[model samples]
Target: MTSLLPRTRTMFPGLTEWFDAAWPFGERNLVRIEEVAAEGEYVVRAELPGFDPEKDVHVAAENGMLTISAERQARKEEKGRSEFRYGSFSRTVALPRGAETAKIAATYHDGILEVKVPVAQTEATGQIEIPVKKD
Candidate 1:
């Protein structure tokens, strides 16, 4: 079958060699993460497409820091195949002020690991009415 996309090697003459230099198949074990704050919780999500949360992923929080890591080893039969790299990845995120470390929780679903941390409620003392001058 004819492929609409140009052959990879043709585009970058040395790319194939560069890819195989590290892994048999040019692969990079890069973990992407996103942290967001909403309402009363801070949410952190990491992408671990092929990892099994039970064995390959870990989440830890200490000293106002949250760390997420994932490790995956390629099978013997899968070596030299074009695929995600077989290696370990880790990312550390700084906890925002007032983050409740004790109330943190994590859940993994659909290749994403999400960790939620509660924020201490801020005291809203009272609202002050602005005095406007009438012309």
Candidate 2:
């Protein structure tokens, strides 16, 4: 003779729903970003906690666009145990009309990445030449 037991799905339907809602598609976390503009420069700030300066952070500019990217490893204790995983993030912004690319610079301090983009100077207005035509 054999005995039958209750199915696992029937026992914990609500728990399944809660787990699904908490981590849909098992996404770990989201990165925060912020940008600001100041006189003669455009500043971009990104939050990158617990990242190495030499290995994780990178910045570049090409064709009037500036890109900032970084990768931060999650805490070792929680890497494989929890569903929360933190990975790399890349963000890019288009340079303004008068923004200078050659003079761009960046610095990272206290888990914050700061990029300084110099604004281009405008030329002084000159007299216009108009041709005379017979009516």
- Leading candidate by TM-score: 1
Off by over 4 Å in 1: 1-7, 10-29, 78-80, 123-135
Residues 1-135, candidate 2: write the lDDT tens digits: 111333264585445444534244554224456778877888888777777867988989998898877776767673355644477877778887688888888888998888899997677679988999989
Name the lDDT value of residue 48 in candidate 2: 77
For model 2, name the residue pairs that clash. Answer: 98-120
Q: Any idea what lDDT model 2 has?
A: 0.73
Q: Provide the lDDT at 66 for model 2.
A: 85
Question: Which has the greatest lDDT?
Answer: 1
Give one digit per residue, the lDDT tens place, for model 1 in 92-135. 88998889998889999999999999988787769989999999
Show pairs that collide, candidate 1.
Answer: none
What is the lDDT, from 0 to 100, of the residue 61 in candidate 1? 89
- Residue 88's lDDT within candidate 1 is 82
